[model samples]
Target chain A: MNNNTSIIVTSEKLNLQTCYDFVKDPSCGGIALFVGTVRNHSYQKEVTLLNFSSYSSMAVKEMTKIAEQAIASFDIYKIAIHHATGDLQIGDIPVIIAVSSAHRGAAFKACEYAIDTLKETVPIWKKEHFIDGQVWVNTHP
Target chain B: MKIKVLFFGIFTDIFGKTTIELEVPSPINVVELKAFIIKNNPKSTALHFAVALGETYADDNARIHEQQVVALIPPVSGG
Candidate 1:
C-alpha cells in the first residue's frame, strides 16, 4: 500500500525540501511543489497566528484519496502531502503538496489542481487569531 | 432515531461542543437536516456548511444513513 507516498498528521513543522526530494525520482523529469503558509492578515484583520485542527484519521484518508485522484487524473509519478496540526504561529507552513511528472506542464497543472481541490474537499479547518479577536474559518467559500 | 451531528468552525462556536444528537422519527435527509440545524440556531442561517457522513462529504440530495455520524463543516475561509 505504501507506494512512495508520504501522508502524515503532525504538529511538528514540515520539511519542504525533503518532501520535494522524495518525489524527485528519476522517472519523473519535472517536479512541482506548493506550500500554504499562515498569513498574518485575513480580510484586513491583524492576525496574530492560527490554530489548525482536523480529525486525523479522516483527514489522512481524505488526503490519500485526493493524491490518488490526482495521480489518476494527471500523468504523475510521485506525490507527497504534509499538514500541520495544533497551534501554528504566523507564517507557519500549515499545508504542503508536491507532485512529480514526466513534464513541467503536467506537474504544474496537477500540483495546482491538487491544492485547490484539497482545500475544497479536505476536512481540515483553521482558527485565526486576530489582534482584537479570533475566529474559526471553514473550507468552502 | 437519534443521530449525533457534529459541527465545526462557526457552527461549533455557536452551538457549543462539536456534536449534537437529535431524535427524529426516521432517517434525516440532507435538506431536512440542514433545516433542522438552522431552526435550532437561527443565527446559523448565514453559515454555509457542508455535511459529511464519515469521510465522504454529503451532497444536497443525500439522505443520512441510520445511526451514521454526520458533520457540519461551515464554509471555510482558510487558504
Candidate 2:
C-alpha cells in the first residue's frame, strides 16, 4: 500500500493485466475494478465508434488529483487509473480504474468516486459516431 | 513564437482542427493566451472551455511553455 501501487496511463496500447496487477497486492482484502467499455448504443442510437481525446497532461494531473483525494477521503489501500486515447470501437475498453481497500465498502465507494470524478473533472472529451451521423457533445468541461 | 492548441468535442468543429497555434509574444500565461484567442476570434467568446497543459490542467494562473502542447477541452457527455 505504498506509492508504487498506483499508476495513471493514457496510452493507445493498454495493458489491462499490468494495470490490474499494479494494484493487486495482498493487503487488507477487497480489490474492486471498473472497466468502462464503449457501448454499442447511446440514447437508443447505434454507436459505431468513439473517438477519445485528452489534454494528456491535464488529464493525467486531474486523474492523479482524484486518486490522491480518494486516498485521503477513503480507506483505500491502492489505486490505478488508465484511460485510452484515440479511436475506439464498440466494446473497446476506454477506461479502467482499480481500487484496493481493506474492505469492500471503501473499495466500491472509492472506485465509483474515482470514475465519476474523472468524468467530471478530467480534461478528456469523447466523440460519438452513430449510424446516422456523428456529433461532438459538451464543449464546456 | 508558436504553440499547439488542441480542441476537443464540439470545439473541433468550430475551430475545424484538433489542434491550432496561437501567435503571441514570448512568456505568455494561460489567461493571456485565452484573452488573445478571444480577441482574435470573438465567436469563441460564447463558449466556455478549459485549458490543459502537458499532463496538467491549466487555469488562469498556469504558465505557458514554449512549444508546449495545449488542449482546449469542452464539456463531455460520455459516462
Task: Tell me the spans in candidate 2 whose CA falls farther than 4 Å from its real position.
Answer: A10-15, A139-141, B1-4, B23-36, B42-45, B53-55, B61-70, B77-79
Residue B2 error, candidate 1, Å: 0.8
Candidate 1 chain A weakest ten by summed lDDT: A1-10
TM-score of each: 0.89, 0.79
lDDT (10s digit) by residue, model 1, range A18-136: 78888998887888999998887889788898988776666788788878888888888888888888888888899888999988888888788878877886777888888788877
Q: What is the per-candidate TM-score for chain B?
A: 0.80, 0.83
What's the TM for chain B in candidate 1? 0.80
- List the DockQ of the predictions in order: 0.46, 0.47
Candidate 2's clash total is 12
Best by TM-score: 1
Let me know the TM-score candidate 1 reaches against the reference structure: 0.89
Query: Hey, what RMSD does candidate 1 come out at?
Result: 2.1
Chain A TM-score for model 1, please?
A: 0.94
lDDT by residue for model 1 (B1-79), tens = 7888777667667877887677755766888888777777746357577777776777888878767788887764433
- Alpha-carbon error at A83 in model 2, in Å? 0.8
